[model samples]
Target: MFKCFYPDQYLDSTYQINFEQLYAKGFRGILFDIDNTLVPHGAPADERAKALFARLKELGFGYCFVSNNKKDRVEPFCEETGGCCVYKAGKPSPKGYQKAMELLGTERKNTLFIGDQLFTDIYGAKKAGLFCILVKPIHPKEEIQIVLKRYLEKIVLFFYQKQKKEGNS
Candidate 1:
């Protein structure tokens, strides 16, 4: 079952994922995890973040933030990004992911869920029948559960990286 619990796809870093690159792959919508995926946990957006969101909008790709965090934690960021936010989402559950798709008015086939956790972000997106993009956490201390998850992640990522390299070869 452990092998059954692995992510569908992986990325070296969230920053390296350009909307244009993904657009070429036929992904038109993006659902982002708030903490770690966009910014460090409990951290606010910097100037670069504002610019990034602007570019995402310019690309005409639908994007939204789906976070398991409370409204207090998610609202401000959504406002800052000018994107919709689904709070108290309970990731790995597909509820938030579904809501995001509704907000974007798109189907799962055109969507990409990007986040730092395999269990929540990746699994939930997979369950929702959307493509998943696994990104490294910006900060380990953002959530207590992340500390343990990160440990497990190290092992999973090793094999993931090897497979990716082999695929390229």
Candidate 2:
């Protein structure tokens, strides 16, 4: 019933994903959410993010940040991380994800997305016909709306876990 919101993969952290394996599997591009996915919400890109981007470049992958934030916030972080971005992305809408795929020059078949939220991030990727990875939020503190969503996410996740245990994934 709620299958549309289920992620292709769910993990504890974005940093734990194996980009090399994805590359080996013929995935050439990645789209990312900026906030709690990579850092605490609103915090600037840190050294770890920069290093991850560096490793991605070393692996010959094309990548970009698909963020809902305005240019003021997304630009400097992309600049610091040596990555590109599509700001004000209006996620869960196909246009922004399409724009990002265009920016990376990747087709949906070869592109992947990693993010921290189900409603915005995972749903956006799924709607765009891209593989999606859902990572747990990096921090406990979040805006009230997100906290509210987390409660609902738990219900979906419970079903997701049950499905996984059944080998449906």
Q: Write the per-residue lDDT of candidate 1 for residues 93-163, one digit (tens) a residue.
A: 98899999999997888988889888788878888888788887777676567788878877877776676
Which candidate leads in TM-score? 2
- Which ranges of candidate 2 are over 4 A from the true structure? none
Error at 153, model 2, angstroms: 0.6
Worst 10 residues of 2 by lDDT: 75-84
- The true-versus-predicted C-alpha distance at residue 107 of model 2, in Å, is 0.4
Q: Considering summed lDDT, which 10 consecutive residues are worst modelled in model 1?
A: 1-10
Q: Candidate 2 residues 1-169, lDDT tens each?
A: 7788999999999999999899999999999998999999989989999899999999999889999899999998899887679999998897788998898899999999999999999998999999999999999989899999999999999999999999987
Q: What TM-score goes with each of the models?
A: 0.89, 0.98
Per-candidate local distance difference test: 0.81, 0.93
Q: Please report the candidate that would top lDDT against the real structure.
A: 2
Off-target runs (Cα >4 Å) in candidate 1 are: 1-5, 165-169
Give the Cα RMSD of candidate 2: 0.8
